[model samples]
Target: MELDFILSKEEKGPSGKTELIYDLAIIGGGPAGMTAAVYAARKKINTLLISKDLGGQVLWTTEVENYMGYQYIEGRQLMDKFKEQVRHFPIDQEIGEEIEKLDKGEKFFSRNSDGEIS
Candidate 1:
């Protein structure tokens, strides 16, 4: 299943059949997940990030002050910046997809919509 990432123009893929493969597959889009995406891109890895939404717990909070580079920032605003930074890389992302299950595998995850890994 060579599904297209909506925000990206590149048709190149790490997707086919019932599963997709990447040098890295990040399972969230929170501060940590987005940050991992950035690092993976820098390392030139074929990466995928699957998330229900961006920001995770950070988005619900009213303010952010602990993150580096900003003494004070709104949670939503911080997430926006993270999203923007992720756009600059060749990363595959699936948004608004809630994962019901995931399991350990050789590459880490081998998943199906029905929550099976094969």
Candidate 2:
């Protein structure tokens, strides 16, 4: 069955102002992190997914057969499906940077590489 929902444009808050703290902060964009983003965003919880790459190890695989849907599918194809699902929600995705540390506060802070704090 096909499902439909409105996808609202992400609203930009004040510049440099941290908003509400997320219920969860996922630090990888493999299958696990992507899945978590899908679930948390659906539940209307503030969620942030930080990863250097979106697909992670899954992007390197050429073929996957044990995933239970098709007998076989290209690894990139599978990752694409995951990414499509993730785009449906307001999950925050930061790419191309490694997470150095996580600071818990009213609004969580994630420090990226290059010593350029965020």
Candidate 3:
């Protein structure tokens, strides 16, 4: 059965199936995840970023002092910059949704919080 959800525009294959493939799938939108996305994009890899929301624990931080390039920056501001950098690349994002399950086989299959697979 086909899932009703469309993860991304490139998800549908010639057979009309949601067969999107990616060289990397970052499960969170935290500082680490965002960094990984940027690196993967720089490497010209087909990448997907899935997260309930961006920023992660960093969003809760009031001030960011160790984030390089800036002596001090607000957490939100830092996250915004990260978001902007990630968006500048050709990376696929699935934000505002949580992954309910991940099945590993010849390929990885992920089910979102809404029970939709992509």
Candidate 4:
């Protein structure tokens, strides 16, 4: 399977820098995180989703048979379905990237110092 770093919106600042403003920031690309991002986007919230990999452990699984919807499904295939839904929205993703440092200011959430969000 091919894992692409799906993304858009460069968001360069005055000096070609990135902005550090987001109403929502998701740090994982698992089912839960993706679901959160989908919900946030549906609400028209400014959100950024960063993750080292898209499927996480789910991609390593040989088969997922217990899930309600489908009778049987391969891990990679299921993940692709999730990815399809995710791609339907304008969700920004930082694939193959990990959060190195996190700093919280006087604000509500912290920014990704490495420009993952900031």
The sequence of per-residue lDDT tens digits that candidate 4 reaches over residues 1-118 is 0121223333554467664456667888988888898998998876778888888788998899978798899999998998989999988788877765665544333344355543
Query: Can you write out model 1's per-residue Cα lDDT over 1-118, one digit (the tens) per residue?
Result: 2322233234333454234445566777898999999998998777888888988998998998877899999999999998999999988888876666655533344355666654
Best by TM-score: 3
When 2 and 4 are scored with lDDT, the better candidate is 2
What TM-score quantifies how close candidate 2 is to the native fold?
0.74
Kindly report which residue pairs in candidate 1 clash with one another. Answer: 1-16, 1-17
lDDT (10s digit) by residue, model 3, range 33-118: 99999998898877888899999998999998966799999999999999999989998888887887887655467788788875
Range of the 10 consecutive residues with the lowest summed lDDT in candidate 2: 1-10
- Give per-residue CA lDDT, model 2, range 1-118, as digits (tens): 0011223224334575433445566789999999988998998877778789999898999999979788999989999999999999998766776877766654345667775545
Q: How far does residue 23 in candidate 3 sit from its true spot (Å)?
A: 1.5
Task: List where candidate 3 sits over 4 angstroms from the true fold.
Answer: 1-18, 114-118
Q: Estimate each model's TM-score.
A: 0.71, 0.74, 0.77, 0.73
Query: Candidate 4's error at 39, in angstroms?
Result: 1.1
- Model 4: pairs clashing at backbone N, Cα or C within 3 Å: 13-17
RMSD of each: 6.1, 7.7, 4.7, 7.0
lDDT at 58, model 3: 87
Candidate 3: which pairs clash?
none
lDDT score, candidate 3, position 88:
92
**What clash count does candidate 4 reach?**
1
Of 1 and 4, which scores higher on TM-score? 4
